[model samples]
Target: MITIPFSFIPPKILERLSKHFLNWGAFLEKLFPFLQQELGKANIKISAKQYLAMSFIATFFLFLFLGFCLTIIFIESGKVLGGIFIALFLSLFVFFMQSNYPKILANRRIKKLDADLLGALRAIMIQLNSGVPLFETLVITSKQDFGELSKEIKIAVDEISGGVPQIDALERMALRNPSPYFRRALWQIINAMKEGSLINKVIENIIINLNKEQIVQIEKYGSQLSPVAMFYMMAAVIMPALGIIFLVVIVSFIELDEIVVKGIFWGLLGFVMFIQFIFMGIIKSKRPSLLEE
Candidate 1:
């Protein structure tokens, strides 16, 4: 039995949905030994390239765990029907949790990068505008540890020193950000530089756009605060309590038959759960689209 009934407060159910889409969360455990004997047997690139190896590790663990769960359910439970249901539920939950892991990390990095951007841009603009060589300026920015943006820019500089083309490095950084703006900006920078294009004013213009984006986000969330609060109160608190109370009143005061009371209780409980799902989906929609997975 669920410790807490489906309600608007927690998001576990939706998380389970994501796990269904990202099967790695349910596939990893079964593959670990082979992965260990193969990928682990080979020495590999360690840093940014580690994500691929990490993904394999995650996949291996997930499948093994899920298979273990199934093995237990089938052999130990005896009741195949209940065991199958439980196994399915657990598999879905794991997938949902894993699918959202990157989303959670990405969300945090995006927020941190947003906060760090203004400072980094201001610093970069000052350096570039003051006749500081772009390479040295990037090195300086990388050295400061301004946050995610700094770390990424520094990595691009490292790639440059390693003889990687500057444009390709920048493009890869843009891919990691999942941002079109970064790609477009870096592309323009690359083209202009090769053509002896003057880009100081262009950097300033990009800075302004970035600043505007932050401001627009602030205003959007600020505007949403009141309505979101109202929604929380109505969905999480008011509705569930009212439902339980209605069941209580019918059970105690109303001269209804016992069957009628039980039926009403079950009906109210189901309806409350349905309402919870609706409200949860609504609240989720109001959050960033990238978080929807």
Candidate 2:
């Protein structure tokens, strides 16, 4: 579970402001229908309206801060209009980014769950094969250090302990979790339990399927990495270096002012850094989540 970062305002003040904008937030929630489910998947306990309201508040503060700083810079350069435009653009960017933050956290949780799922399932299978009851197996799995998977199992265990039927608890877990593989495994277990089949046999089949899926993911990732690496090298390394040299030559031939040359170099540096950052993110995002650490 992640807490939304809005340190610019006190939590109490932010909460108050968010409540004041609840109607607007409700309208925005209707525009982005999936937000409520994403909040659950991300383990954020707040309602969609509350979260969206806070996002708007944070974005509003960000815009004010940027406007202040950029106004000073643009005032010196006699470009106040340009500063306003840039600040508006940045504020909107931040709002959209905040809107997707729950989904990002959900994806992160899915990756953590996927990374530890196989080991956790194997532990469960072993315990069951040793004649441990399903509920006890789940409790033991929940106590183990299986990262996010352990935490999710703990939730189900808690639900069962609180008088929920095992099948119903497991079904709720499957429905709320963002990982397809985890949900599929849970559904299979629920089905096996319903049919009075051997739980160990169902778990074994799930392990085999997961292993095959992991292998396919690895193969696809390998095929993707070659081209992605090539693109990264061209875009982030060779192009930046060559472009800098070309720009330097042009500036020299044109007898550009020293300040202008410095500004151009700084802009190119920023552009190169941006390209490198984007390529790094792409490479990390392409990594197969199921790979063993």
Highest-TM-score candidate: 2
Instruction: Enumerate clash totals for all models, in the order shown.
Output: 14, 0
TM-score of each: 0.57, 0.92
Clashing pairs in 2: none
Q: How many times do residue backbones clash in model 1?
A: 14
Cα lDDT of model 1 by residue, 1-293, tens digit? 11112123233443343344445423543433333222221211222123222343444455556566676768765765565566557655654454334444555555556556667767888998899988888899998867667777988999989998776777667655633445456666777777787766677877777667656765776687688778767876797788778778766876878897788778767876887787776655455421212
lDDT of 2 at 20: 91
Report the lDDT tens digits of candidate 2 across residue range 76-136: 8899989988998998887888899999998888898898989999999999999999999
Runs of candidate 2 exceeding 4 Å displacement:
1-7, 76-78
